[model samples]
Target chain A: MARRKGVESSIALADAVAMCKVDAISAYPITPQTHIVEHLSEWVNDGELDAEFIPVESEHSAMSAALGTSAVGARTFTATSSQGLALMHEILFIAPAMRLPVVMAVANRSLSGPISIWNDHSDIMAERDIGWIQIFAENGQECFDLTPACFKIAEDKRVILPTILNFDGFIVSHMIEPIEYWEQETFDKFLPEFEPQIRLDVKNPSTMGAVGVPEIYYEARMAQHMALVNSKPVIKEVFAEVSQITGREYKVVESYNMEKAEVALVMMGSLTETAMTAVNNLKAKGIEVGIVRPRLWRPFPTEEFLEVLGDISVIGCVDRAYTFGAASHPVASEVKSVLYTSDKRPQVREYVMGIGGRDVRIEEIEDMFMQLIEVKNTGKDFPIQYIGVRE
Target chain B: MEHLNVFASKLVPGRELFSPGHKACQGCAPALALRYLLKAAGPNTVVANATGCMEIISSAYPDIAWGVPWIHVAFENAAAVASGVESGIKVLQRKGKLAPGKVNVVAIGGDGGTFDIGLQALSGMLERGHDVLYLCYDNEAYMNTGIQRSSGTPMFASTTTSPAGEKVPGQSTGKKDLAAIAAAHNVSYVATANTSYPFDFMAKVDKAFSTSGSKLIHIFAPCPTGWRCQPSDIIKLGRLASQTGLFPLYEYQDGKYTMSEDLPFLKPIEKYLKLQGRYRHLSKEQIEIIQENINQRYEWLQKLSRVSQED
Candidate 1:
């Protein structure tokens, strides 16, 4: 048990937000993410949070409104999922390019026209390279912990890009959990007020968002590129600072019993909690195993992942998204490239798991260990499998 | 003669905020309007030029003809961007960061960029209540893009796309009611002017500077090449348009009306239409209908004036 309060798995984000205290909120009603904003809106209305709340119409307009308010130099936040995120796709690219340190909460859901509202990585998979710093949470506790650090990472002058804290639909967002709360005073020292370098001032008129000819276009693009690359070091340092403040350690890639393991499991988001349970069960039965969870996806923790998973034989990659017809999912493809330069490249096996809100059972994870073990014994590559599917 | 002298002084001022050697065509009314406007408004003003002929010519390469501190942002969002600039200035004024003076923010855009593409950004800026003067130099077509028709193109006017053909005889829709739109935003001052009547136009420019909040001066700048007329016929065409009551010069302040120039009496509309190749194909009946539309709109203005002065 992760400590008791209610069901030990159920805790209201609003209850936590009321404790954290935000400066501004920009929200629109979108499925799976609606519950998060509902509580936030109530607090703002009841004179509880003391934040500027902009109730916008469409997700596209909401995103623009957030950017507009943020551009005027304010600490801003918003929440959305799937189609709502898709509508905000254009501005998602714009927000980071402008280097506005906006923090957003995403309840990960399957994107649709076929219309299925379920837990999956389909929404975030599409935006993996939008130049935003993305972090996934396995539970409500991580969701609460990651948010305070989200401010630290995005606002570090070197990494002045938007950050998204993603928690799975129904799996984490809807589920209640006992989260250790931080007071407003605790957050005040950790995450300070936002102060922008170039803000819209009425007195000394200066222009922004002007079109650049070919002469200056290259330099502008280079600046944003350098900022993203330079941000990785700042991110690690901020995580270390967060560790000192809360006495809770975090890394870009969190390792769980990976030492002295032959078969290592790699996954992201809420599925990792289930995967960790499976790894522990298998370890008790004399099967050497470990789990590596990727928290930061955008600045893909390449060097850290390789350093931690050294001497591993087989690495089974689990993705919450299906990549249609390909070698595997988007995560699996990037993992392959990350291992390419390593001296001892592990036998990489891709697995598509828990898509469209399918329940990820412990039995399926146990079966995965058996398959990989059998492959190692027979000296054969493991066949790719979708963890929970009707067929 | 008194009005003419005042107008002429505005025309031949010492300083040129918008310098010469820029690429506006010979006798481009917007260029002349800039010359007259800067004289009336003075040099210590921030100009926000939109992406059009003005921007292309003035800020081409590294050379800038804008003698004062000027910015050239994108096409549709010039008004919104200007709002940012003005807002920044306002906040600075609140603090002790800026010097004390009655600062002017002039937003300049051509007909296509103003009436069509930039409508939303413009509306937002006006609604925000910025102390800014918006100048629309209406050439009635996408003249910068080789004379394509725009929302401000007059009825019966032809261009590359809206040409008089077997199916249709040039543009059928009336010019966009931009002044009315600005008036709807409840701006302090809204007016229509042309380069031909430089005095009346400059007087309104003077009024706009003196007034607070949002103000708009929509000037009918005739394009000779775009309209397929003689280059020297620019001033004559502009004069004919106003004399024929086709482009009336007027101003409005807080729902109150004022005719900047007494129309005296209307002249033949044929004189305005015949000189330009765009309206050359129009039949006598079509010309008469256009003339009637102009007369009806003018009458409506008269009624509005009566209402304003009634009390």
Candidate 2:
């Protein structure tokens, strides 16, 4: 192995692109995500990766450039966060609507409030409706592993919507971890040459984006929507294929030893690792605990989530983001809806934590588990719990 | 609109590419420019629109005004998106999947979207030599945002952002020479068209679409609201704007210039500016100053008529 060294999330992303020898990257320099591009530019400068690094002025330009490059039969990637993602907010709808399987890494951060720079889920939360398949990772290891997988999932012939592999800023992005690195030949077999069904060409001379009058507008939009919902099955297939090749089992909604468990903790992003630590510690003391961590945020993985929480009485749905006076937290609201039709729906306990880079401790998570068990045992309800707040 | 089929009286047969019920004022010149553009480019072309009034109008919820494959990306990336579509087609053609030479990619935008916000992406597309025709329907202001001044706003033309007041006259700077900028890129073709003369405008649009490398057209699209004129006066303003030599119709192809319409004699500048509230504040001296500048620019253009002796 090439000397074991720790890499930042941004550095790890650049290294993945470098090591994989990705062909194209359309990037706009937004803070937090700029480090990855900086390292990528260096890689290109040193002749390490043969790629077209388009330095765009805005996030919208970045997505547009990526769309163009990908349409031209080139594998493409990009990175942005918060305002950049919001600015890209418009094209975010177009990329997947056009079904361009472009892989982007979103450095998840809080959307502007008082304008904070640290980690939260506000940005990607805002993009929830843009039709891009979203995946959140817990650490650098997941970030590294899921990047190539992102390209695979988005490029799947059945599911051509753009895919985003999100890792919280400074949480998993700046941290380092060990990774079982795979080789290029392995990927070559894993993802064969990108044979896109739809592409732009002079020879064929078919227009990709044409104005549709009212007569057909709804049909076109409905077609794009159906294509996205159709991506659910394809996502499962890609996960299976990746696990077979890498020998690391993956799921849209994955369970961490949740079987026969009374109370299951449900969450997303890197906080799951902290929750896992809490789960293990409590289980050692004869507490029945488990975690249902969501990797796929978009397409919600309703079936898999139902399976993961099967027969469980209570779910501690921890959302690291706040929706500001919705029914509850964004994730909490969605989890409640997904469990709407189930016969064995759990009594969901919504807990809000890890906002604005608030440190998520093992003890805090253990306390959440303890609270959920009681919520199940007593049939008593409490308002949304806020953990680790200073008075 | 200029009757291009003057002698034959043949109507351009097709469903409308730019339809009615847009949020635009009664008669915006870009609205007409799009009509002529669709006529020339034909129904076979795809339009990549930047996020602007045009996009908003044609793609509003539950209704679309376009008859062809159209897409609207963000404000400044229409050219890049067209490049993507063009490149996609190129790959499709190479793979023997897409039929060759049947479809055209056209990017349409206002002056704000084209001359300012989309400059970089447009420049990049021209540089990359994509087979895309970028159309700038120059209405002089960002009309979609309530008639604000853009980079293409004409000198002394009052706009919401460039208001004429005690301290400042409207739009203190001259209109940016966008066609020359495109020409500087050594693009295959670049042209200046006026909505007042639809024949000349459509001719340039046809030539642009027929060109292989990137071609750009800057159309002088008059806005009734922005110009503070009667809605019906749009066509008249467009024509008067050209007849006064304010927006001379011409084309640049193969590094040669051809003034599309001969201007042996032209109307005075006041004939063009007198109808618009934006220019209502201009004094005799200011109007004279604008006339002097227009004459000088046209005379300079006359010098480049490739066949001065032949003409």
Per-model TM-score of chain B: 0.95, 0.94
Candidate 1 C-alpha error for residue A25, in Å: 5.3
Q: Indicate which candidate wins on DockQ.
A: 2
Superposed Cα deviation of residue B241, candidate 1 (Å): 4.8
lDDT of 2 by residue, A311-372 (tens): 88888788878888788888898889888877767888889888887888899889889888
The weakest ten consecutive residues by lDDT in model 2 chain A span A201-210
Fill in the DockQ of model 2.
0.24
Worst 10 residues of 1 chain A by lDDT: A1-10
Against the reference, the lDDT scores of all candidates come to 0.77, 0.80
What lDDT score goes with residue A24 in model 1? 56
For model 1, the DockQ equals 0.14
Stretch of 10 with least lDDT, candidate 1 chain B: B88-97
